[model samples]
Target: MAKQALGMIETVGLTSLVEAADAAIKAADVTMTGWDKIGSGLVCGFFVGDVAAVKAGIEAAAEAASQVGEVNSTLVIPRPHEELGQMGPWIS
Candidate 1:
């Protein structure tokens, strides 16, 4: 089985994060875990799937979100550490 990967897209506004989540869902076979508000108008969207899909999803998300608002940062962790799951629901 392929190891699951985690993808995150952080944006400067709720609308950007929402757009990122939508684009990620449509562009790849990943599952949207959930999103969180990071204060200072920053929001983050999370997703999980195979490494390639996660990477693809995040890339698509960032591109789509940048059109409407600021994309602060994006990350993809392939085969993330199991301990990370204990942090929150979005990690797994």
Candidate 2:
């Protein structure tokens, strides 16, 4: 099974945050599953080959964002099919 990872990052700016997240994702050599913005902050979404990559991605993302200012991040190990199961549940 493919290990899944999710991250929630609180940052100051959107553009820079996304850029940082992107760079971090690349550095970690992982695929970016998705991403979005919430208020003035950003919520980065990503998936990797293993738990280590996910953890590393989060750290790298934080480091990139920190270049500008404070950046807080949270990561989670998602259950397989949970994401898909939850999809569209609240859309309508």
C-alpha root-mean-square deviation, each candidate? 1.4, 4.2
> Per-candidate TM vs. native?
0.96, 0.65
Please, what are the lDDT tens digits per residue for candidate 2 over residues 17-91?
676667567777656655555565644444444566767777787787787766656564544455553543211
lDDT of 1: 0.92
What is the clash count for each candidate, in the order shown?
Answer: 0, 0
lDDT per residue as tens, model 1, 12-62: 999998888899999999999999999999998989999999999999999
Clashing pairs in 2: none
Model 1 lDDT-worst window of ten = 1-10
**Most TM-score-accurate candidate:** 1
lDDT of each: 0.92, 0.58
**lDDT of model 1 at position 8:** 91
What is candidate 2's CA lDDT for residue 63?
82
The superposed Cα distance between candidate 1 and the true structure at residue 37, in angstroms, equals 0.8
